[model samples]
Target: MKKLFLGFCLLVGFTTIAQTVADPPFMQDTADKYFFEEAAENVDLLQIASDRNKAIKVLSSHGLLLPHEKIIRQDVQYRPLLDMKLVALTEYQGQFVYLTNKAVLSNAWAGKLYINHNIKTPKAMGIGPDFLTMIAGENDFAIFKNNQEVWRSSINNLNPISVQHDLNSGQFLILTATGLYQVDSDLKTVKKVFEATNLTAFGFYGDTIVLGTTNGIQILDRNTFTITKMDQKLPWTEITSVKNIRGSLWFGSTKGAFKLRDDGKYDYYASKRWLVDDQVVDLAEGPDGSVLVLTQKGMSKIDFSPMTLAQKADYFQEIQRLRHIRYGFTSDLAMKTPGDISTGYFHDTDNDGLWTSMYLAGELFRYAVTKSEDAKENAYEAFEAMERLTALPGLKGFPARSFERDGYEVGLHANGFSEEWREKYEKENGRIWQLSNDELWRWKSTTSSDESCGHFFVYALFAELAPDKAWRDRAIHQIKIEMDHIMDNDWHLVDWNGKPTAWGKWNPDYVNGFPINVGDRRLNSTLILSFLQTAYHFTKDKKYKKAAENLIKKHGYDENANRPASVIGFVEGEDLSNTWNHSDDEMYFLTIPSFVNYSFSEEQKEAHFNAVKSHWEVERSEKNPLWNYLFALSGGKNIDSEESAWWLREFPMDLIDWKIDNEHRKDLTKIAPNFRNQTYTEVLPGDERTLHLHNGAYRNNGGSDGNREYAPYIYLLPYWAGRYVDAISAPQPE
Candidate 1:
C-alpha cells in the first residue's frame, strides 16, 4: 500500500514538471484590443481626429465616429465637407487639408476653407510644420511655400507613390517605386538616400527607416542607407503599408493587419471579427489612440486601451445579449465544418445534458452574486430543460442524453441492433417516447457517466442555492429519484436494455477490481462518495451515509480520493490513463464542491479538501481561470486572481468558433506535446491556441469549418464565481 502511494506521487511529479518553463505572469494593466469594422467598400484613405471628446473617422469622402455602433448608414450626416472625389486627406498645423485633382482645400472648425491651386494634379502630397507642402507627380516634384511653388525638380525613371514629413526633424521624404529621396528643409538639396526593389511603403522609427517591400519588411540605417534587419515573420510576404503609432509598429499586409510589440512579437487581428476584408490599404492613428485600418471593404477601427473592471463588465453584458440572440441556450453539437453555419446543428453531441448543466450552473452563480432577475429566469429555463430529459424517456429516473423532434432520425441506428437490443428499444418498452403534442419529442438513450456527474453536481447547487422553495423541492426530487435508481440497480446506470452502461458502473466489484494505480478506480470512488454525500445532505437518508462509509472503511475509497489527481498524464501499460481526459477532468472538478461542502463528517471534509488542494497544485500551471476560481471557492491558496482576470479580458468577444490556425506563428515558444496532447507555451493558450473542449485558451493549432458557438456561461461562470468568492471585485452599477 505504501509503494502504491509512492508510485502515484511519482506519476504526478512527472506530469507536473514536464514543462521546462512556466508561462509568463499576467499583468492587470495589460491593454485589450477591440475591433470595429464597416462593410462599405472602396475605402482609399483614412484619417482620424478628436472631435467633441470623440474619435471621429475622416474618410476620403465622409467622416463620423461612434465606437459602440456596429454599422453606419450612408445618409447620416458626416463631416461638413462637401462629398467629392478627393485625392488625399492630411493634417497640417492642426487643420485638415483635403486635396483634389485641381486644388487643395484646407478646413478648420472655425468655418475657414483655404483652396490652393499651385501644384497641378499631384500624385502624393505631404505638409510640413512650417506650413510648406511637398507635392510629387509622375515625373516631377516640387516644394510649395504659402501656396506658391518655391523649388521644382524633375525626376526620371521613378513613379512617386507618396510624400512624408518627419515631425521630429522637419525633413521631407519622397517614396517612389525604386528609391527613397530626402529633401532638405530649406528646399535646396534632394538626395537619394536608400535604394530598394519593389518598395511599397516606408515609415520613420527613430533613426531607422522601416521599408515595406514585396518580399518582407526591411529596417535601414537612416545615415548609412544600409539594411540593418529584415523581418520575414509576417503572416504574408506581400507588404502593403506600415505605420509607427505611439511606439509600436503596425503592419498591413495582403492577408491581415498586426501590431509589432516592443518585445518584437506580433498580435495578429484578422477574420471578420477585426476586418471585413484582409487586404489592408492604409493605417492611421485616431485621436483617441485607436487605429483606423483602410481595407478593400471600408474602414476598421482597432482600439487597444486598457479597460477597467466596470468596462469589462459592460462588455460582457453585450456578449450575453448576442449569445442569447444568435446561439441561445442549447447543447453545442459537433460540426464537420465550424463557422460555416449559423449554429451547431450539424450533429448532436452525447453530452448535451452535461453542457447545458454547466451553463445552468453558471447562471445559478450569476443569480447568487447579482440577484439579477434575468439570470434567475435563465437558470429556471435551463433547469426545466434538464428536468424534462428524465421525464421524456418515460423512465422513472433515467435521463436521456438529449431530445429532439421526431423525424430527426440522423443519429439513430436501427439496423445494427441485435434481437436482444431491439427488444429493449421496442416502442412498447418505454425506451423512446413520441409525445402527443405537435412537437414529437424523441429522447436519446444510453446516457453516459459524464451526464450523470453533471446532473448531480448541478442538482446539489440548485437544491442549496435556489431562491424559491419550488426549485429547491424540484432539485431534491430529482436527486432522490436518481440516487434511488442507482442504489436499486446495484450502483450502476442501467440503459433501456436493462444492462449497465459502459461507464456508469460504480459497483464495488467493478471498482475494487481495477488496479489501484489506474484512474477509473479512483475516479469511480470519488464520484460515488460525492453522490452519496449529496444524496444524504438533501434527502436526510442514513442509508446514503451508510453506503459512503462502507466504501471508505471496507474498500479504502478515502485513500483513493487523491489518486485521480496524482495521475493526470500518461501511465505505462494503462491505456485509460495514458492521456489526459478533459471530460474526466471536468467531472472531477465539478464533484469537489459537493464532496467537501456536504461531507459526512469533519474527517471526510478534510480528506476532500486535501484532494482539491492536490489537484489544484498540479493544475496551476495550466492557468485555467475555471480551475483557479474553483480552487479559491474550495479554500485553496495562491489562487491566480490576476491570471483569472486576464482570461476573462482576453476571451474573444466574437464567440463564433471561427477557424483559427497559429502553427506558423514565429513569436510563440512551443514545447513538445505531453501525454495529454497539450503543447506548453510561454503564454496562455486562450490567446494563441486553437479552440478545443476542456482545453485552455492557449492551444495553438487547429481549425474548424462550421460554427460551434459556446454558451456565454463559459465566461460568466468564472467571472461570477470570482465575484462570489471575492477573488474579483464586483463592478459598480452603470
Candidate 2:
C-alpha cells in the first residue's frame, strides 16, 4: 500500500523526500491556503456560525451552507436551507435564525417559522447578546424582544447601512451615511458619536470605532470622540470594509486586503497566490483563527500555522527539481518561464556559464556538508557543462556565453560587425550567426570578463574539493588554457576580429588610464590579481605569477587593491562608482573565496582578506545572504546569520518576475532616488526590486519584466555556503 501511494504521489508530481525533521529554529510557521468553489458562486458573505472548529458558513448568490476544508463545494444536504435565499444569519435566543426578503425564519434547518416581520426592505440586521434583535431599513430601525417589537426609531434622512452589537462594550452601534449612532443599554436614548459624509463601513478596535470613508479610514476614540485619519498609513485610499478580528484590524479595499499589526506595521496580501480576485468585499474569521476573505469571484482562506525549516528546505528542493532540470549531459537549464515549470523552455542568458557555475559551487558545498551523492552527481554534471563551454567555441579557451543546436536560435545578437556585414547576416538570420563547421551546433560569441571570473572561481573549487582525479586534472587544464589565452592576447579577451571584447579589456592602456579614484581601476585590478593567483595555484605556472607581479609593480595594482572601501558606493566625478554595478559586485564577491583560498603567500592572503572585508563592510546594508555567507568564508566577523535567515524568508515563493508596483504605498518611507536606485526600505532587495539575472539585489520599480529569469542558485548558493562555513546549522533528521 505504501509503495502504491508513493507511485501515485510521483505520478501527480509530488516530492517524496522526507522534509519534516526534528524541529528547526527560525522557522516561518504560517501559510495561506486558498479555496475556489464553483458551488458557492458569487460568494459575497462568510461567517463562523458555530463554535465548532472549521465550521465556516458561507452565503452566496446560489445558496448558503457549511464549507468543507478539503472539498471545493458545500455539502448538498443543506440545499433546502439554501433555497430560501437568506440574506443574513444570526444566533437569536439560543436558536439559529435567518432573514429572507419577507420574513425571519427560526430553527432554519427544520423550516420553523419565527417572526413574520413582513419587512418590505432589509438593509442590515444584527442580534445583540441580550437576545434583542435589531433590524433596519432605509430610514428606520426596529428593536425586537421575543418576536415582539420593543421600540423603533426613525433615522431621519440617514440610510442605515449596517448594525453591529459590540460584544466587548455591550452597546449597539448603528452605521449610516450621515453619522454613527450609539444606543444606551436601556435601548431608549441614542447619541451621534461621529459624523462622516461618505461612511461605507465601521468596526470596533477595542473601544475605538474605525470608520471607512471614501477618502480613507478614520479612527474615532470612544472617550474623546476625536477622529484621526489613517489615509497616509494605508496602501489604498478607497476602503470597502473594515473588520476587527480579535485585536488585529483588517482593511479590505478595491486593491486587496491588508492587516494593520499592533506594532504599526502592515502585511499586504493581494497576489493571485493569496486572492481569488484583488477586489475584497468582506472578511470573516473562523473559530480556529483562519481568515476567510470574500471576493467578487470566490472565497480565499489564510490559515496561520508554524512551518519548520525542514519544510522550507523541501520547498526549495522542489523548486530545483521542477525548474533546474538537466538539458544536455551536465548543463542544468535555468527556465525562462519561472512559474510554469512544465514549459521546458530555458533562457539563453549572456551569463549562463556564470549562473551555472554558481549552482555548481553551491552543490559542491552541499556535497561536502551532507555527503549526499545527489549533490556530488549534480556538481560533476555542471563541471562537464562548464568544461564544454571552453572547447565548443571557435577560439581556443574562449568560453561561449551559451551553446545550442543550429535550429535553436535565441538571445542577443553578436556585436562589433560593420553595417554591410550585419546587412549580409540579416539576409540569413537578422543576427550575427556563428555556425559550427559541421553545421550541427552554434555557440554564442563576444563573451565578457564576468564569464572568466565565474570560470576561474568554480575551477579553483573543483581543484580543491573534487573527489575524482580526472575532474581536478580537467579543471586545472581548463584554467591554464583560459589564462594562457588571456595572457597571449596581452591581458585582453580577443574576439573573432582579433580586437578585445568591449568589457574584457584589462591591458595597461585601459586599466591605468582610469583615475586613481575610479572604481574600474580598482575592480579590474582586483579581478586580474584573483585570476592570476587562481591560475598559478592550480598549474604551478610561474608565468601567471610573473604577470601578477608585473601588474602590482608596474601598474600600481597593489595600491589600487588597498584603495579604501569608500570607492564602493558613489563617487562625485567617477561614473563607475556613482552607479552600483551589480554585475561587478557578483564578480568581486565570487572571486574573493577562490582568491583568498588559493593565495600565493601569507602577504597575498592578508591583502585579499582586507579587500574582502572592506568590500563586505560597504555592502553590509544590503543584507544579502550570499554576500554575508561568502564573507564569512573569508574569515570576516559579524556574518549576520539571523539576517541571512531573514533574507531567505523575505524571498517570495513565487519566483516569476511579475511586475509589482509599491510606489503608491503609504506605509513605505520614501527617499530621494539616487544613482543606485536605492529604496527607502532598509531590508535588502525590496519587494518592488527587479529579479534580474545578475542584479537581483538592486532596487527596481515593479512594472517591467526582464528577459531572463533567475535560477534557484540565487537561493541555494548562500544556503549551502552558510552551512559549509558553520554560519547556519543543518537540521537533524527525525
Candidate 3:
C-alpha cells in the first residue's frame, strides 16, 4: 500500500508536464549549504591560529583572548588572560599558548599561568614538532622545549618580522624584512635561504617556500634555493597573511581573502557576503573544513554543510514560518536594529496579495506532489488572506492592494514624495486609500497589473488541481468575479472613484496608446488575453472567448505579444519605453502558464510557446529556475536545468539583506551598460550577491544594507513548480 501511494504521488507530480525532459543531475546529490555567523562582540583582532582539533584561538588588543569551538554553533569560550598584555598567539599540542608583555603564558586545564620562558620581550611565536620558537627582540630568536628556553641566537641583524615551522622539511623557518632564513632541528645555525624585500607572509607548498610580498608572490626551491617571482593575479596585492590548509594555499590581502584553486584560478571571498569587513587580517582553518576570517570588526566563520535542494527548501520553510508570515500572508521583515533578526517585525507591502498568491501557488504544487496536510493548510490560509482583500473594499470585483488595521498612517501622503510629484500623481491616479465597510480597517487602492497576474494564475491552479471540491469551487468562483470585473468595466480595474487605476488598464485605447517599443503595449495585451482565456477555460463561457478573439483580431495583440526582447531598446522621450520594465517580466511569466495551458487551439498554443521561448532565450543567462520551469511547461527542450540547479544550490542560507558590493573587484568583467542595466557580462553566484527578486536584474551590482529580510516565496515558487513538472527530482538517497 505504501508503494502504491508513492506511485500515485509521482504521477500527480508529473501530471502537468507537456513534454518530459531530463531532470537536473545535480539535484540527485548533496550540494553545499553555505551560511555565516559573526562573533558576539566586536573587537580589534590581532592574530588567529588553529590547533589539530580545529579549535580556533583568537588574540586581540589589551590582553583580550578567546578560544572558539564549533559544535551546534560557533561558541566563544572566554578565558582570562590575567591582565597580561598578549602580543601573539599560537597553539602547541592541543593547548593554546600566548606571548605576553610580561612572559609567555599557557592556557591549560588549570588556568592562565606562566610558561617559564627565559626570552625577554617576545615579539612573535611559532609552533614546531616538539619545541616553541619565538622572536625574542629585534635581532634575537629563541627556541623553547618543555616550557624552557633551549637555545637563543642572534641573527645577522636582519630585523625579524615573523617565524614559522616548516613541516615538510622539519625546520624552523624565519621571515625577516629583507630575506628568508631557516634553522635545522639541531638549532645550530640560521641560514638566509632567499633575499626578498617588503616580505609580509610565507608558507610551504610541497618542497618550495611561497613568500608573499607587497607586490606579488615569490617561490624558492628548497633543493636548489632558486627564486622565482610570479605575476600577481590577486584581487588586491599587499598580502597580510597566508596559510596552507588541506593542500590549498589561502591568502589574506588588504581587500579580501581568497584561495588558490587547483585550476590556477582564485576563489575570491570579499564584501559583506563572506566577511564582516573587506580588510581581512588573518586566516585559519576552522571546524568542519571551514575558514575563520579575522577583520577589524570581528570574526566570521564561513561554513559549508552538505545538503540537498529539498533540505534547503525545508530550511527556508522554517525561516518563513518563523519570521515572514503576517496576518496569514507572506510579508517582509523589517529589522529595528540593522542586521539583527531578533528585533524584526513583519510589515505590509503594496503587493501583499500578489506575493501571498505566489507562496500559496507553490504550496498548492507541493501539496499535489507530496499530499502533505501541512502544505494544504498553508495554501488555504494564504487563500483566505487574499480573498479577504476583494471583500474588504465593499466592491464585489475590485480588490484592494493591501489592508492594515485602523489608525495606521500609510499611502501617498505619508510616503514623503515631493509635492509636485504627488500633485502630478493624484492627477493621473485618484486617491489611493479607502476605509473598510466594517470601519475597523483601511485598504490601499490603485491595484496594479502585478496583483491581477498573481490572482488569476494561482486561482486557476487551485481550480484545476485542488483535492477538495469545496476549495476548488471557491477558487473557480473567485476567478469568475475577478475576470468579470475586468471584462465588465471594459478591461480596467475600476477604483472606488469610478475610474480606472493607474496600471490596471487593458482596454484597446490604453494598451494601444503606447508605441510598439513600449513594454506595456505587449505586456497588457498578453495579460488580458491570458485572463480571458483562463476565464473561458474554467467557466465554459462563450463571451470570454469572444472577447479574447475580438482583442486578438481587432487590436493587433497577436503581433504585439510576439515581439522579441531584442527590440525592447530605449525610445527617445518616452518615459515608459526608456528602459526595460522588469515588473512587466514578472507579470508576463506568471500569466504565461494560463496563457499556454488554456489555449483555444493548438495554433494559439504554439504562438504562446514561441513567446515564452523568445523571452527565455534572453533570460537564460540569469539561470533562474522559475523561468526555466515555466518555459518547460510549454514543452521547451532546452530549459537549462543545470543552470537552474546552480541557482538553487548557490543560494545562501542567510537571507538577510546584507550590503554586497562587487563593483570594486578586479576579477569581474564589466560590460557597457545596456537597456537591461546589465553591468557585468557574468552573474555572480547567489551566495556572493544579494537575494534577487524576480523583478530585480541579476546583473546589477550593490544592494541594500541589512535592514530587511525577505521571505522564501521567491525560492519556494520555482522549486516546487519544477518538482511538479519533472524539471527537478525529489531529494535523492544519500
Whose TM-score is greatest here?
3
For each predicted model, how many residue pairs clash, with residues at least 3 apart or on different chains?
Answer: 14, 3, 0
Misplaced by over 4 Å in model 2 are 1-99, 103-117, 130-132, 144-151, 184-186, 222-231, 271-273, 286-289, 295-300, 326-344, 414-433, 568-578, 684-694, 698-700, 703-710, 732-734
Comparing 1 with 3 on TM-score, the higher-scoring candidate is 3
Candidate 3 lDDT: 0.74
TM-score of each: 0.77, 0.83, 0.88
Best by lDDT: 3
- Cα lDDT tens digits, model 3, 1-734, are 11111211232232244233333323211112112244345446677766666666667664444443321122235545545567888766667777876567665646534565545556776777655554455677777666667777886564666788877677787887788888764747778887878898888887777888887677788666688557475666788888887687988888778888676767677666566677778887766767777766656676656677787788788888888888888988889897678899876677888899989988988897898999999999998888888888877788888888876724443222466866786676655667788888888887888899999988888876678889988887888898999888998999888888777999999889888888888888889888888888778999999999999899988778878766676778888886677777888888877777677887887787688778778878777788887776545666777778777777776777777766666556778867877677777777667666787756445566778888988888888877777667777765
Model 2: per-residue Cα lDDT over 401-511, one tens digit each: 777788785654543346675476557443443676778877776678888988988887777667778888998898988888889999898765566766787788998
lDDT by residue for model 1 (444-495), tens: 7767778889999889878756799998899889988888888889989887
Q: How many backbone clashes does candidate 3 have?
A: 0
Output the worst ten-in-a-row residue range by lDDT, candidate 2: 1-10
Candidate 2 accuracy as TM-score? 0.83
Whole-model lDDT values for every prediction:
0.66, 0.67, 0.74
Q: Which order, best to worst by TM-score?
A: 3, 2, 1
